[model samples]
Every structure is written in C-alpha cells, then in structure tokens.
Target: PFTLRDKGMKHMVGKNWRDLFDLVIVQAGKPNFFTDRRKPFRKLDEKGSLQWDKINQLEKGKIYKEGNLFDFLRLTGWRGSKVLYFGDHLYSDLADLMLRHGWRTGAIVPELETEIRIINTEQYMHSLTWQQALTGLLERMQMYQDAESKQVLLEWMKERQEIRSLTKNLFNPQFGSIFRTFHNPTYFSRRLVRFSDIYMASISCLLNYDVNFTFYPRRTPLQHEAPLWMDQLCTGCMKTPFLEEMVHIR
Candidate 1:
C-alpha cells in the first residue's frame, strides 16, 4: 500500500524546526545515505510539481540543488572564527566540515567508542592481575594448612601485611590527586575500589569533610546500624537511663 511519493514525502517533511530560517531546503540529496546510488536534486513547487531541472547542478537561492555547505557559506558572506558545526555522523558531516572546510566540528556519538574501549581495557588488565594474585595466595594458604606448618603460615601473613602497608603508602597520594582533579567527593568514593591501592586513603578520608561526616562511621566494618525509627522517636526515649547505661558499658 506504500508508494515512493508517500515514503519520500514523509522523509522530506518529517523534520520539525523551531522557526523558518533564511532558507528552507527539502529533498536534500545526502550522499552518505546511499552507498552506490546517486540521486539527482529535484526542485518542486507547493503542489510537489517539478518546477526546475538542474539535476546535479547547483543554483543559488534555490531549494533542493546539488551544492556544498562551503559554497552556501561563501555566498552568504559569513566571515567569523566562531563558527561551530555539530553532527551525529563523524565520517559525513563532521569530517567534511573539519577537513575540507576548516570549520570546527563537534561529533556526537551516542555511545563514545574511544571511552568504551579505554574502560574495557583497564578493567580487563586489572581483573586478570587480581585474579592471578588471589589464586596464588589461596593455593599457598592451602599448602601451608595441609602441611601443618605454623612457620610457613606466619611468614605468609607477615608478607601479606608488609604488602598491604606498602600498597597503602603508594596508593594514598594517587587517590588524593584523583579527588583533587575531579573535585567531586561522591563520585570519587563510589569508584574508589576500581583505582590503585595508593588512592584508597583518598576515598577513606573523604568523610573528613563536614558534608561527609555522617558517611565515615558507616564505612567502618564493625559499626552497628541504628534502629529504623530511632530518629523519629522522642529525644527523651533516645536518651533513656537503660540506653545510657548500655552505651557507657560498650
């Protein structure tokens, strides 16, 4: 039930604009849309009747003509260094704007390929290293346990403690630098585990700030959870004699 007229007309008029600009173009032949086919430009009247026949030739001040954006800019006498061209397709609009016309182009990829690759690569390397180290450590612990070797166990524990201390020392400065560079405490805290050991203290010490004071005690593994309704309860009930005694005992 569909025809070329229906599909073609819908494609041409589907774009919604805020307001009419200096020129309104329709049925613009975008070459990238087709790989091998070359469709010629057609100028049509209000009734969609062919008014002019220029095929691939460009005409000034006319609609649906085969023309480059550079030619249009030249004709309009727009001279400025602040021109910015934005496009979703990098190879088509952005490439032509930047390489051929020397215009500043911003390419927007819905999912940035470079960023994805970087993140994936980092994760892959880190995971492989961590998994190998953990597996080796587990194997050594099992060997010591089966052999009933207390000296071996003690030596292993000492080595682990030394490694942990060295890791903490190295990572703390890098963690602080990450926080300082990003300037966002919450984001740093959330992604802290992914960073190297040197950055661990930056995440741990983030709660030192007044805004983050409440989160510090919560991070402690031994900290107990307060009752759900503790805040909503009366202050007198919160500070009851039995509660004060229990707190003092602890």
Candidate 2:
C-alpha cells in the first residue's frame, strides 16, 4: 500500500529528510486516516506484502503501512495533543492535523516570490503614496460636506482610482499578490491564518538561525498586538507587519 510519488522515499534529497525520522510510515492514508475510524497497522515486506502477525508491533528500523494514529501514539508513549506537524498542504496536511489532533502547524509556500519582490522595492513606496493620498481626500470630504466640496471630491476620486489601478498592476498584470485580493485576503491566505502558526518561503531559512533561540513576532499596531509604543513606517501609511518592514515577510 506504499504510494511511490518519486523514486522511493530513501532516494529523496540524499536521505537528509527521512534520515531524521525514528519511525517511517508509508502510505498511511493521511487525511482519511485522521478523519475516519482507525485502521490496522501492518508491517510491509520488501516485495510489498503485509505480515499479518506484525500488526500493531512497531520497530525503529521497520517500515509500516495502513497505521492507526492511536497505535503510533501508544508505541511512542505520546499523546495527540502534544505534537507539532509541519506540512505543505492546507486541507490534506494542515487542516486535518489541526481539526483532529490539535497539532500546531507550519506551511511552506514557494509562490510568495513574485509578490514579495515587488513589495520590497522602492516602487512600493510610490504605491503607498497613492494609497495615503486617497485616504486624505476621503477625510476632507467627510469634514467639508458642502456642494462645492462634493464636486471636488468627485474629481479627486476619479484621479485616485486610476492611480490605485496603476499601483496594483505594477506588481502583476493578472493577480497582485496571492495573499491578498484588494483589501480582503485570498482564500489561500485565510487558511494560513486559521491553521498555520507561521509560514516561511522555505524550511532552509531556519538553518541560519539558532535552534535554541526563541522567535517573538514584533508588535504591529491594530493587529491584535498591544505594545508600549508604535513605530511609524510612514507618516500616513497603514501599520506594516514587522517582518514586512524588514522586507523578509515569510
């Protein structure tokens, strides 16, 4: 019942990924295994035949299939509530683990490059100015509330709309950022908020940091974080995420 996605699991990335695992479960039926009733855990032979007698008996160096989560926890002397799983899928990997096992999760996203590059550059500053200017015009309309002011508001609105359109298209012709759809976020990013604790462009980014050190996300104003003071990214810009200001938002 082993699903061979590539040239066997051992040959994947020079054994670095799989070498760290104390137990290897192949074709464990994943999301269904987490959602549905428990299944029998059986050991697989080299020819891919199951040993009926080896059911529920796990060893460090052995390969297993069709395993139950309960069997895994029992053998490891652990609980489902005490696990943190890293995965690449939203529904299949992160969602199932969060809903069923209550595991903390992290997502790997490589598609963030095109969007991040545009946001990090000076061209993004031009975009910011247009946004702030539009905000200021709206504020003036609210304060004045006269017939002459309304005429002025109409003129400014048309000019600002064109600038907003230009700024958005500066990043991409089709979609600006996969994480956002104008003011509201895209469905892909919404899933990240509900399930993932943190996301990174790649797992290799962790190698540069100390494993023993702790990471505390900086307090961004109006982002559910209350701190002593606010650091201004711009005179009138929306509060930026700490990492976004550093141009390394993962």
| Candidate No. with top lDDT | 2
Candidate 2 residue lDDT tens string, 47-83: 6677787564577766688776766766776545556
The candidate that achieves the highest TM-score relative to the unseen native structure: 2
Off by over 4 Å in 2: 1-12, 15-18, 46-49, 140-156, 170-172, 217-250
Instruction: For residues 1-250, write the lDDT of model 1, one tens digit per residue.
Output: 1134435645765533212234444544454322223444456554446665654444443445344454446455543334555455445545544554566544444333433343356443353333334334544444555455666656645654554444333324344222223213445343332221112112224345675233222232222333345323322222333223324222
Lowest lDDT 10-residue stretch of candidate 1? 193-202
TM-score against truth, every candidate: 0.31, 0.72
Name the lDDT of candidate 2: 0.67
Cα displacement (Å) at residue 210, model 2: 2.7
lDDT of 1 at 23: 46
RMSD of each: 18.5, 6.2
